[model samples]
Target: MATTKLTLSVDPEVIAKARRISKLRKTSVSAMFSRYIATLEESKQRETPLPPMTKRALALAAGTAPVPENWDYRDELKDILDERYGLK
Candidate 1:
């Protein structure tokens, strides 16, 4: 396929990172950005929509548990409900 040179105004830090990644992957920065653009286009053309807000909400709620491994989740949930309802 015929390719064109597209000029972009990007931060020097971003250019450094891209150069580093290109070196690690054994490819040119242009090729790396080309693959990225192709992947982005493929995702944009997909039939399925992205996950909704509810899924994001559930993920945020389910982040690594803050409780101890031996803790009883049900007991804590019950206690929370009781406290919420003013039930001693």
Candidate 2:
């Protein structure tokens, strides 16, 4: 696959943080942005919708929420309830 040069206009602070994180992760800022975009693409392809609370919780989140293929509603509900009620 061929890679292309893409330009983005982000806040300087965000770019600085990305650079710091990329260095720590031993990857380039371009790679980090590419992975982030790829993740957004993948989540966009999922059919499942994000639960209401999760949606609310991630109201500030960018792009679509990802739901795994093996995502279990009942188990997730149980876990959320258990954590909420301290019944775990």
Candidate 3:
């Protein structure tokens, strides 16, 4: 594949974190940024609400044993999946 180099300024802390993650994953910073940018662009195309989930409802769903007032089931479900898969 053809490639090109481009330079841009970014926050130092963000670059440091990206570099750390890139090294941990054995990939180049450019590649990591490319993937991240691609995902962000893709998300921009989505039109749905992406499943509603309030923070208080999420806590109850995780078996936190304290269902906050006006809890919603959607949050509970998202919390369950996030916990099981470490998606967070």
lDDT of 1 by residue, 5-85 (tens): 999999999999999999999999999999999999998888585578977877888977677788998999999999999
Q: For model 3, how does the per-residue alpha-carbon lDDT over 1-88 read when each residue is reduced to its tens digit?
A: 6889999999999899988999999999999888989999999888465345665666558875776799999999999999999997
What's the lDDT of the predicted structure labeled candidate 1?
0.91
Of 2 and 3, which scores higher on lDDT? 2
Candidate of highest TM-score: 1
Considering TM-score, where higher is better, how would the candidates rank from best to worst? 1, 2, 3
Clashing pairs in 3: none
Over the stretch 1-52, how does candidate 2's per-residue lDDT look in tens digits? 7999988899999999999999999999989998999999998898698899
Which scores better on TM-score, 2 or 3? Answer: 2
- Please list all clashing residue pairs in model 2, or write none if there are none: none
Residue 3's lDDT in candidate 2: 91
Backbone clashes in each candidate structure, one number apiece? 0, 0, 0
Residue 41 in model 2: lDDT: 95
**For model 1, the run of ten residues with the poorest summed lDDT:** 47-56
Give the Cα error of residue 37 in candidate 1, in Å.
Answer: 0.5
The TM-score obtained by model 2 is 0.52
